[model samples]
Structure formats: C-alpha cells, structure tokens
Target: MKMTKRNGVFAVVLAGMIWTFASCSKDDDTIPANIEGNAIEVAQASTIAKPGTTVSVALSFADPGNGTMLVIHRDEAPLRSVPLQDGQTSYTFEDILPADLEEGDVVPYAFFIADEKNTITSDASAFEVSVALYDEITIGSSPVYQIELPEDGIIETGKVKLAAGRKYWLPHSVHFMSGTELQMEAGVELYMNTETGETYDVVIDEGARVDVTGTATAPVVVTSDKLLRDQDAEPGDWGQFNIKGEGNGSSSGHVEYLRVEYAGDRGFRLQGVGSGTTINYVQAYRALGEGIMPTDGDVRMKYLVATNCEGGGFRFGDAYAGYVQFAISQTTSFYDEVEAFTIRETASPVISNVTVVGPGEDVDDTHGMRLRANSSGKVYNSIVADFPRRGLRLNDKVTVTDLQGSTVFAYSYIFNVPRDPYRDDTENGNPFRGYLDAENVFQNPFFNNVTGFEDNDEDEPILATIDGIGTTSYIPQTVKNSAFNPASIHAFFSEANYVGAVSEAAADWTKGWVRDYEGNIHQ
Candidate 1:
C-alpha cells in the first residue's frame, strides 16, 4: 500500500515513538520471537544537502520472509512507503526535497520497518539544506549544488570556473593554493559582503593563478555587495584584489580588462609580480587608498586609469623595474599631502604618455607628482596640470644633480600649478627649477574639456571630461619636437608625433577599451 497522511500525523507518531523509547528500560533489548535473528541497519546520511537535489539513504537488513515493509518519515510530511522486492538484502532510497526550503533549515527524518508480527523504528537523522547565495551561478558537481568552504579559507585543489553573467557573493577572505586556478568568465561579477564589518580579499597565493580574462565589451567586475543592492555604494566598503606572484622569472598568471571599484584599500595590490605577468586595460575608481600599489616587483602595465581616489593614484615602493604607459589619473581627493603619483624608495619605473589632473586651486598643497626617497625614472611625454601646489617636488633624499644624472624627464608639460613649480629642499640647492626651465614646457595641454578644472568647490561634483579613448574634448595644442627621441624610445611605444597623453588624431590607443567613469560606458 502507498504511504499516506499529512505531515501532522507523521510528527505525532514520531513524538510518541521518541517518548516511548526514552521511557523504556535498558534491559528491554529483546526482539520478537517471530523475527528473532533478523537485523536492520541504516547507513550514515549526509550532513548537508543543497536545494533542488535528491538525498540518498541506504539500508541493509536480513529478511524474515512473512512480507516486510519500510516507511520513511520526515517531520510535518506524509510517510513514504518503500516496496521491498523478494530476496533483496539492501535498498537505497532517493529522497528529493522541496526547492523552496531556506538555506539553514534543518530537516529531520526517520525510518520504520515491520514484519507480519513485529515492527522496528530507527532513530531520527537531521540535515541542513543550503540557501542560494549567488545569482545565476551554480556550485558543486552534483545536480543539486553544495555550498562548502573549508575552515582554513583556502581552496587547496581543483579548478573552479565562475561563469559569465553571474554574481558571486564572497563572505570571507578566500585564498587559492598552488597549482590551482580560479577562472572567471567575461562579465562575471564578484561582490563582497560589507555589512560583516570585516574586510574580504581575494588573494592568489604563490603557484596559484587567477585567469580573469574579459573582453573590452564585457569586462570582469569586482565590487562591494552594497553596490549590487544599491548603486550608490561609497569607497571603503570592501577590501582589495591582491595577486601574489612568483618572483621575477615566470608569472603566476594575468588579469586583463578588469574593473575594480569602491575598494576600501588599494584597488589592486601586486606583490612580487614579475615581468612575465601582464596587467592591462584596468580601471580603478573611488578607492579609499591608492588605486594601484606595487611592492617589490617588476611590473608591466598599460592603459590604466584611476579616478576619485582619496590616496595617490599610483604608488610604487621598493625596486619596481617596469614599463607603464598610457596612464591617466583624474580628480584625486586631498588626503594629507597626497598626489596623483607617489613614487618613493628607489623605484625606477619607466612611465610615459600619462596625464595627471588635480582638484583645483582651493585644495591646499595637492601635488601632481611627489618624487621622494631617491626615486628616479624616465617620465616622458606626460602632462601634469591644475594642481594646487608644486607640480613636482624632490624630497630631502634626492637632489637635482642626482636627478640630472640618474633620471630623464623629457617632452612633458606642467601647467596651471601655483606656489613653486619645482621644490627642492634637500640642501643641494634648487637644480630642478633650472632643469624644468630647460627641458619641459609649462603650458596647458589644451584638453577637450578645459571647464573641468575651472571650479574648486568641495561640494561640487567632479566630472571626468576627457574620455582618453576617442572623441575627447582635450588635445595638446602643440606637439613638441622634443617629445620623442628616436634614439632612446622603446620599440613597444608608438612613434606618434604627439607630446601629451592624448592627440587630435582619430586613432587613439585608449579607444574601445577604456571605461568612462562618470557615464559608465566603455568608449
């Protein structure tokens, strides 16, 4: 006969059985005489089950011929009867649960068996079903996916693919182990839970790799969970994206066409990243700390943009021997003597074709570039404009004579800066003023939107006028002859006869991939 009755009847029977068994004496272990030597055993069940999947329960028993019956009881549900075939010793029951169960719900189940004259009821077992945390993405190998995370927070083995058009919620910091890879499809979004009051980071440890290769049209996004619920999330809502690379030889992996926004700290942290790794076409916006930070590595990057960062846009520490080109920083907020580019402590990065625009004259002492701690590099064909204070400052550790011999700043433009264009307080006297007078131009780059620098009101919205890619309102009025030294220019750079970051020509390098922060469009 088929199993029948509602969940209430099952609950009542289960309660009565529990009370009766609890009150029974320890000496009452005898079996009925008719089923004397027969025994029944149920295998251990799973502790957890995901929604929309079947739970399997296995049982083994000795039959006493007189027609046996098995009934499965779940709390508040009808009893399910299983037909025991002739001469069968073991059976497996696939119990499919309802899809609407909440994630943390505990379900109780019990098994009952009976012969012609005797009946036996097994102890109750409980399991928890997981709630759906991500939208449009599935986890695990089973048809009903399982949400499992180890206690150590590291995914030690296997490759997991985060499919496109899905948003995954990260509740804690996750680390990837050696030889394992986390591949993210284009248009995939990773959101961090910010309400927990603890910062969450995605760290790719040494020997591990994160292959997040997205197209210009469908870039991968890493942002705060608050932004997923409401678009008005502010900076410092979440932690950063960190990639700890294998030291200077081969790279651990690469990340391309990625956008990170509203990060609490640095947007991207490259630790010990070598020359073999590539980080291209990346944009960081509204970061509480530096937009991109490099420590102890030889980095290679191009087409990078940092906007509305409270700290410096690009901050380099230690020895970073790399090439950075086509970079742009716009409207960095004043943060205790911060600048667009903060280069310090023996970093010699070859930076070219860049633009740094500051928040206007009212913001006190905001710099375009703060070069200190013996940091020297070849900065060419760049524009630094509208800063409130000195355009470039060389700190006490470095001198003009040291710069003239070790660094090269050629064909660059510094415009609209007030109160000392070049400051040198290192006791070596001011050689930077004479060098600036001789090598660089102090004129406007004639950006497409000159009005972007007109106001200094702290409450006003800072708009990004120059798209940097195509159809920008800003272009240098004159392309200087000294911009390109054919003898010293690297082969990777285009020999475009332009002085600043942007040109009047229709073919702009930043076109099609660079994202417009204000408009939220990839031009």
Candidate 2:
C-alpha cells in the first residue's frame, strides 16, 4: 500500500557481509496447518554525510519454504518479495545519498516473513543498524574546484571539481565534494545573487574546506547579489550561505577578514558534529534569520560582528560550547529585536565582551537581554543599553536554580528594569514575568560620550557610546527604525586589554574588507 504523506540531510554508509541459509529438504507429504513462507532479513546502516557521499548496505537472510519465495524489507517502511527467476540468490543495495533525510542521520530496517497472500511483514525480526561517514579524499587524488560567477548571470545549482591550489569565486549555489578541503584563498570574492523566493541558495556540505582570509587592508568578502541600497533584499528573503557538517562529524576551516551580509536564513549556520570548525575576524551584516546559529558541536569565534538581524544579533541553539571572544553586536532592529544572546534549550555558550542596543518600541517583542527557559549561561563584562521597554527579563518559566549570578547581587551593575521612558512588557502583548529587580549594577555600564540612548523618531534610533572600566562600546536605540550606519554606531568585546576587537595590533589581519558608508571599518 502506498501512502501519500512525506516530509524531511546527508546519509552515512554501513558495512555488512552476506550470510546464506541452507535449504532443508522436505518430504513430499510434509504439510502444515498454516502456509509457511521464506524470510529475507536485511540489515541497514546510514550516516549523515554531505551530498554525493557514498553509502553502502548489506543483505542476508534465511530461505524458508512456502513453495520457496524470498521476501525483503528496506528500513521500516514496507517489505517486498522477490521471485526466483534463474539461479540468482543474493541481494545487495548501495548508492550515494541525497541532502534531505530523517533528521539527517541513520535509520532502522528489518527483514521477515511472508503471508499466503504474498505480503511480507516482520514482527520480532527487525534490527537497528547505522551507516557512518569518513573523510576519503587524498590531497593529490581529489583536488578542490573553483566556482566562478559570470558577470551577467548567477550560478544556481551544480557540482564543480576544484584544483587543490586554486581559488574560486561563486555567483550562486555550489555544492562541494566530500572528504575534501578547499581553500577560499585570501582576497577572494564569492558573490551570491539569489532572487526572492529561491530555495536553498548555497550549501557547503561535509568534508569540504573554505579558507577566505583577508588582511587589515584587503579582506575577502561574501555578499548578496543586490546593491547595497536595495530595500527589498532582507535576510529572510533567500536561502542561507550555509556552512554545515552533518551527522556527528566535525569540520575545520578559516574565515578571517570576511564579511557576509543579507543572508536569507542565517548569515552563518555552523554545526559541529564530528570535529568542530573555527571562525576568526568575521562580520555579519543585516542578516534575516539568526545572525549566527551554532548547533551541537565545538566551535570557536573571535573578533566577530553581527549587525541589524531581523530576529536577534546572534543565537546559540543546542550544545553551543564554542569559544567566542572579542565580539560586538552594535545595533539590531527593523524587526522585533529580542535578546542580544538567545540561549535555547540544552545550550550553554561562553560569551564575553558583548554589547547590545535595546530597541525603543511601544509594542511587544523588544528586549535588551532575555534568558529563556531551559538555558543556563554566564554573561559577564557586557553592556546592554537604551531599552525602550524592559532592560532585561528573566522569565518566570525559567528555573532559577541554573542561574550563574544572583539577581540581587550587583558587581558593578546588573540591571533588570528599564528606565521611565521604556514601556513594560505587561503594558503590551508581551507580559512581564519573574523578578527583574531594579537597582543592581555589576559594573557602571557607561555610554559613549553622550546622554541616554533613545529612540525618538520612528525612522531613526538614538546612538551613543559606553566607556567604563573594562568595557567600551557605542550603544544606540534598537527599534524597527534603527539604522546600520558605521559612523552612528559601533561596538566591541575584547579578550586582552584593548578598546575593540580590531585595534592597531590586528590592523594587518583584515586588509581587504570594504569600508562602511562613512568610509571606515565596520567595527
């Protein structure tokens, strides 16, 4: 029977050996009350790998007698019986899997009995097995392929073979080979021009490497196809410039002095399944989805920037134990800017030297900082500013037991309530919950050479800077009306005793990054 319902990763391959069953001769008068049938047991294993990766399966079963017909089952879906033609006796299945699967991992299968009506079904005969993935490319054997975009066109979808020592520029979606490490050579420009409503613009699968290094004067840039002034090209309108390693695998690459902007899904989606990856000196601008989504793996990010994302600046989903230092989220608005850092369920991220500007909206869905339910994290030496609504909201639904710091204990300053100008969540559709006590400061979070940061006009945000003891930042009003002008706003979180992430010491690292609208580095 065929069912018309379906929904959905890469797959891993399994190793199996063929085992044969000996047929027992039966007497001519041998008969039973119930009709007997043959059982063909199939054991399958799979791993989540990149597209075009190899996946293998092994089949073995016993031959029961019911006039002798062999039955087989693939996974847990259904079973089919194969008729004996000549003398063929064994079965084998193997192929390279696609991108979309069940949670992008292994599946279970069984092989069992057949009824008199020729239907094959298994009860206690099902077994669970899995196929795993491995990196199989030799340096000289499999080289990297360069993806060059035509000046007049966009490359949508295709596979390209890259030479190991060469650099490539992509104009659209390019799926790379597995078990291969390809460098995005220093000073390379990978451009993407995805129109509205296009599905999955670009994907970097497992076993592939990208090294886009930029110096202080000339950094590599991966940007959208549309011009800088186009208003219709928001982050969520297209797919993602995704960097993902699927199914319990790890990836290692370098993205330094690079700027990725106007992403549809997320500017960067890094998953550490095998061995995690590393990102340094990267900037994400005007992203649509979560600016950077790190899921279930080990990753490290240093000297990064995320500005003007629709949802939030940066989001950590599951198991975000990555190393992040010297980061800045200056101003984010135009959509409901929630928490500067959203630690979802079962995720713990070590974040330091962060800055967030609060939006001044009269409605719901605007928060400077919010620690959601099932998320326990430590936020130290950070600045949160200009919250037109609540400064910070620790929801009542969240278990207070896992909080790292106390609500009442103030180091220099730890604020919970907004000033008189901001409206409370209860006033809007977003209700205020929990004990967000006022009158606490871990440290005196001072603004940059200005008065309070406020959102006056619905078309613009108020900008200023905060320079106190260990923290210095340019804090601004974060509302739907906020703008991402480099001159008006700036932020930085540093590891050493420095003012910003990119100071004079690291000036030589980002040599190729373009200047902001005001002819300055987008700090």
Candidate 3:
C-alpha cells in the first residue's frame, strides 16, 4: 500500500509530447549534418502545477564537447538560452508559471543544443506540467489547526477525533494502520498540501475505518489547498480517500453528509466493504477517477450525487452487490464518453430512483449506463436522459445474457437518447437485448421545466434548472417487492412512487450540498 503519486519525480514521457526527431533531426536554425557534439533528452514526466508555482524539469545532456549552449523554447519560442560548461550533462530546469494561465491550458516546450556552431541536438519532449487552481485553506488559524497530529502523518493506533471550524492539511499521503479509527467531525475541511508534496491520500488499512459525521449544514469537505486567488479547482487536485476491509470495525466506514472535491483517484473508494458499513448523503464532485466506487463489497448508499466528474460517476466492479437509491450523476462540456454508471466485473447492484445525465452531442459514441463484463444489475424507478449515445448499453453477449437473467430492470425512464435507446454494442444478437426497456417510460422527465433546457448557455447549462419528475407518469405495475421489505433487503430504501431521482412532492436533497453548474459549492 505505497500510494505514491508525486509529480516531477520520475523520468517518463508525458501524454502529449512533440518529438522532433527519432534518430536525428535537422531544422532551419540548426546545422543539418556532421558536427555531432551535443545531444539532450527530457527527464521528467508530466506535472500538475498551480498558479505562481514552480514547474520543475530535468534534462540529461549527452557529450557536450567543449562549450555549448542549451536553448529552451516555450511554445516554439525561445524563452532562455543557457551556456553549459564542458561536460555538463545534467540540469534541473525550474520556471515560475504565469498566474494568468487558465484551467486545462497546456504549456509545451522543447530544447536544442548548439556546439559553438548552431546545431540542433534533441527534439522537444512532451509538454511538462499543467496549471490548475488550488484550494486556499491555510493552516494554524485556530485551536483545531493546533491539534497535535503525528509528525510523520501516520496514525498507527488509538482513535483520533478531528473537530470542526479549522483547516486540516496532509503533508503527504497519510496512512491509518489496523485497529485505528479516524473520526472527522462536522464542518471540517481536509486539504492536501500541494506546496510540500502531493498524493495526499487517506489510506485506511485492513481492519481500519473512518467515521465521518457531517450534516447538511456543516458537511465535511476534502479538497485542494491550491484554491487561492484567481485559481480554479480542478479534479485530481489531491489523491484518494480509500476505505478498505469488511468495514466491521466499530462505526468504521460510516460516512454521512461528506463532500469530496477534485480528488485525483476515487473520491471515496470502498473495497471489500460489507453490509455493516453505512453511507448517506455523500457527494463526489469533479473527480479525476471514479467519483464513488465500491469493489467486491455489499455496500449500500442513499442521496449520493457526483457531478462534472472527469471519470465515470458511480462505478461498481469486482462482483459488488450494493443498493443505491436517490442518486444522480450529471456531466457537462466533457466529450470523453465518460459514463455516469459503469457496472463491470460481474457486479450486481440494485439501483433505484436515479437520474443519469450524459455529456452533450459533441461526444462520440458513449452510454449513460454501461453494463458490461458480465455485470448484472436491477435498475428501477430511474431516468436515463439526453445521452448522445445509447441510454443503456450492453457491451457483450455475456453481459446482455446476464442482464436478462438478473432481476427487474423495469419502471424506469429513457428519454432524448438519439442513438438507439437500448443498444447491444457487440451486436451478437442476444435474445435478451431489450431487458432495460421493460415497462420503462420514454418521455421527458422534466416536463415542468421544458424552457430550461432550451438554451445551453443559461445558468443551468445542460441540466435542467430544476430537476424533478413533475408531470412524468410513474405507473408502477406492481407494489413493493417482498425482497425489499424491512426483513429481507437493506433497510435504506423507501417506497418510491416517482420515476426520477427527485420528486415533485419532496424537497431536493442536493439543495444544501453539491456543486452547481457554475462550480459554486452549495451553502
């Protein structure tokens, strides 16, 4: 469990790099042939830097004969030209990024060496690091910040309780060993120290647990410490919050009213969790990986929402059996075909009263609910809408066969999916292809807010200004099943008379928490 994900520590090629030449290169500014005196190669992987932060790089030079010049170009323009002494082969490059760079903006650079006579040595490596906004929660403002934590940031034994009203920071990845319980009180904000080191994750080892007790008014927040002035928060600002084991510890893995923002990996990952765990009113906003995922677990959750996630919103894998009710996953402006719900690896979860919103029509072929890898699940009283691709997709024949063999996929709604509402991606002609459309509605669920979706530039963006099943009919053909009774199923489910995540009769659960379309956190 060595969860080390630091930036600029490894010498690897970045994702988007421009290599000028494989063997040797000739450019207009270089001597084309002969004088093979100098060569250099980039020695740093991609990095994530905040505004006004130093972007560090390493370059290894080869055989600089006597006196040579190393020229660094930024975006194809010469930024700095350095004179290397004889036999200077290694250099650490550091530059202060401009504070005005926006999110998702990349700064590309390359280098060339001249041996007395101008000669191109090496092509440009890939882009170095990316600039993003950081959270502005400084430490040591009050008593809560003065609480004595382990100097090495490891909690091995005993129960630790972190109260509210002050800032919390993790220097690096913090590890909670077995028999340890970390209790986070309400109104607590945990931020990772980007200035010191990244990979500021919370790892609950085997037999360890975290009890997060937050309320709607004072929810616990896990975000970046780089959200300073003129900086915007992006996903993967910090590492993950991983909860392991069967969750049998005392009140372990019991989280409520917690909001995780801009987490690098999963916001909250439950691995091998069981029925003893409890989760309610949890949100994962703009996660770099899956927002909320449970693997090989029987975890149950309610009032869960993941919005604008770069990764899939709610994913379950490794034969997970969970109960998800009153959940929603919405994305806007991303075209990566990131699914809202990805059920894979033979997972079988009972999902009810959910609304899955997909990215816009500019995206490629994708799906809202991707049922694949022989995963079987029951989706009831849900709404899958506005997907550019299929609403419910089956990736293979085995997946389609498993879906048909599983329990109910009825009493849901599928709307505005231009690509076939239900599609067999493998096209194996499985007989159970239409299992997702049984007794499901095909009309608009937001009938009360038609004008809200008429414009994409409005305040609400792609999602409706107000989301609810106003006039949409939820004609359930049968009553509550015996399996969902108080004695049989997980007792987290209430009788749902509506089809979508929100009801016209009750208050929206996302009002006090969750981020809006403008990237503003709710108060």
Q: Rank by TM-score, descending?
A: 1, 3, 2
Best by TM-score: 1
| Better by lDDT, candidate 2 or 1 | 1
Model 2 alpha-carbon miss at residue 192, Å: 1.1
Instruction: Give the per-residue lDDT digits (tens) of candidate 1, residues 97-146.
Output: 66755433445666555443334434333322233323333322212222
Q: Is candidate 1 or candidate 2 better by TM-score?
A: 1
Predict model 3's lDDT versus the native: 0.64
lDDT of 1 at 358: 78
**Candidate 3 residues 339-360, lDDT tens each?**
7788888888888777777665
Q: Model 2 Cα displacement at 281 (Å)?
A: 1.2
Worst 10 residues of 2 by lDDT: 13-22
Residue pairs in collision within model 1:
7-76, 7-77, 103-131, 447-474, 448-473, 448-474
Model 3 clash tally, residue pairs:
7
Which TM-score value belongs to model 1?
0.63
Model 3 is weakest, by summed lDDT over 10 consecutive residues, at 469-478
